[model samples]
Target: MAVRSTHSPSKIPTIYQCDSKGRENQTIAADMHGTLLIDRSLFPYFALIAFDVGGILRLLLLLLTAPLAWFLHHFVSESAGIRVLVFASFAGVKVSEIESAANAVLPKHYSEDLHPETWRVLSSCGRKCVLTESPRIMVEPFLKNYLGVDLVLGTEISSWWGVATGFMARGGVLVGEQKAMALRKAFESSLAPEIGIGDSEADFAFMNLCKEKYIVPSEQRVRPVKQVELPKPVIFHDGRLVQKPSPLIALLIIVWFPIGVLLSVSRVLIGSNSPISLFYYIIQLTGCKILVKGTPPPNAKNSRRTGVAFICSHKTVMDPLFVSAVLGRNTTCISYSVSRLTEFLSPIRNCRLTRERSKDAKIIKDILEEGWDLVMCPEGTTCREPYLLRFSSLFAELTDEIVPVAINIRTSMFHGSTARGRKWLDIFFFFMNPLPVYEITFLDKLSPDQTCSAGKSSFDVANNVQEMIGTVLKFKCTKFTRKDKYRMLAGTDGLVGGKPGAVAADKLS
Candidate 1:
């Protein structure tokens, strides 16, 4: 007693014709396969009789009832059509039942086209089948690209003489029960549980067949999906992940070079003569004794009016004081300070370069113009270790007689926050410890062709300075290169708090 039709009947056929209870009384039952079987029953029989109403009145009433039925049927059909069309016009699925139906009928690409998150769900599914309105030929080509899915079911497009006819062999109709039937066939013999997603009530029958269901929410109010977080890659400087000193700050160090030297020298010679040698003796007696191995550079007296630029490694704030005290008043040294050109003209007569004016080439030019030799520490800042900072090319801007000097301090205690072996809070305690030995070496001097050049850029000058210092100190001199002492100072900043070789190896490992 099962029925099949193109569409649901407008109404179940009248149970009986003429006789109220005929074969309609038969009993029907459905088995495991959902097929219905019926037991026929006998109907009660009665003699037929005819009854007549007033002829005209009956005719008038029949006319009225026929038009009313027709009007109502048209109204219902139109309403249903509008509803279906409205759902079809939507860009995406909305209702849970409809979404379930669509997913049951579609593949990963189709679901992803609707929403990206569906990719995750589809990937988790062990196996899948796709049912689309498109023809099998069209869908098969696309499915081959994905390759993971097990099956594709779609309309069959009809072609004649290698040209598409206006018709599809299986018809391109993807409506209502058509979608549901395709989903049922795919699931009928499958071991895996089925899942469905759709957007309308028409998909309910298909969705109901699935074990799991997902419905995309309306775009207007859908909660935003959570995104995965990733870590940013770390950047390295000179082959180490260290905070770089700013170019501006380094430039300031160049501008104020003379100032830093003057302040440090003044502190060393607080109550002594203007002669830097007097200050040197005091530092030696104070136990920060510097061991001078090489003779005072051979050309020390050779450069009469020849401007000598003393380029030293920056190890401590006391470096300039030590170098100047050792060199005495014989040469003029540039250190970080304010106003070099102005100060060079004074009676006390030393050059000053302010941090703000580091880029001014005119200042260096004016200093050399006055016939005084220039002294500078190319590693502009005092570092904890025996590393050399890139030198400023402003030295190249000065006369080319560049002298590379190296200062080594054997300290019982290092000072300042820039000092070695002090915690952030304990930095103030560094000066409490007794000072250490100070060793100074005046290495060879070179002419303009040897060190300074207008052809090279400022960065090149910094590199050249590193090379010059490295040559005299007998250590690797690139920006990446570091001595044992520098590694110790780096520890003061909590970088590595042990011996240079061991700590650096551990860090590299």
Candidate 2:
């Protein structure tokens, strides 16, 4: 395939000016940024790697270069700015860390930023390729895993002894002419790509190679692709940032971090010491919102021999605390791996589970006999998204009266959940949000017909409770469990090597 560029740099035709898309078996080469994604700036993705892998100090260092990065991006070449970001975020960092961030953190952002029209064009092709100026390591996982792209030819970064050198390879940044040459090299023996899509003059180098080409305009009025529209659902992601962190947002978070820490500590102290009647008021005074919807059933039913089992959706580690507060009585929570510090600070009793079915069941029965309502997060782990993990059937087999409690947490800036970060600081992160909202909905208690005592299998009972909660919160239910969650986020079994899960019993005794 061969084509000529008849238009000037500024006059390149936009996607709106060309045919929408086709379902034919054609090959495509689309620029990753601007062309595929709505945003063209590369700082936020780099900032993710900096904070995720290198910690606070490294993230601050990257932030310090923001002004210079902006100047270089505007005054100098875009590649110059990208180089500065790559070096600041990647220098001396482990190659594994970079790969982890790209795999876990960047995908959510990239999926959210996919250009609607551009995706329609790029996704329709049979063999899709992405050519970008960013490091190949940063963009490959998302493109191949989520978008089903066939090839990704991006700028190569240098590394030594499993650590990034923070410098580009001998081929230099894959922009302008470099992208064009790389494209040719990638398809030297294979059939030439039939179509190309780009946003700017820099992308024209490769876009001119295809028989058909379309330019994505700099300003896109079309809405970015919604989460449901994505080719793959991003069920598991690891990062504290609840939203994409532009330079301004990053600076705001940095400035508020210290103040947020103080507020969080105070709130924790208040929650642990305050009386039940005044707990909600005192906590609300600190700028967090707690909303309880639906009616909470009585602590226990006389018809049931055992205490009521509260099956709650997991979000932050504070789910039990809030659920207990809304019920006007405390519930003994099951902690899988709680910190010693948390145990000492909690007013509610925490019972640790052994993960073995028989041992855990005995523990649950023993706790019930001790005159305490039991709250179990059958999902085992916390999921930030609106999807509920598979429920544990152990709870269903133990109790006849089950209350399905659906909880939703809204954060302004920081997420309170993490699979890779310090699990002990989860409450602190939850409190760090400027105006966090904790919404709790207490569904009707499960009838005897829905219990194991009534001929229903434990598995069926567990699924019923899960479906009830999922319907209340409008969240989808999945078969994924704690092991699946850890494998995706932290590369572990979510146990035998880590902190307790968000709903795991806490020692906050």
Clashes of each: 32, 7
Off by over 4 Å in 1: 1-274, 297-303, 330-333, 337-352, 355-359, 416-435, 453-461, 474-509
Per-residue alpha-carbon lDDT of model 2 for 106-200, expressed as tens digits?
88888889999888878778999999999999999889877899999999999999999989988988889899999988887787788788988
Candidate 2 has an lDDT of: 0.82
lDDT by residue for model 1 (1-509), tens: 11122222222221111121231322111010000001010000000000011112322333333334345435754223322222222113222312222221122212112223333343344555555443344334324323244566555544455543424455343434665676656555643234444433444444445543433332433222121110111011111001111223223333443554454344334413435546566545543456774545433345555556677776544455556666665455565642333233222345556755554456666666665556676655554433444455667655666677776655432233232222231212222234446677887665455544656555565566667676666544433223432432222211344422422211110
- Global lDDT of each candidate: 0.39, 0.82
**TM-score to true structure, per model:** 0.36, 0.92
- Candidate with maximal lDDT: 2
The lDDT of model 1 is: 0.39
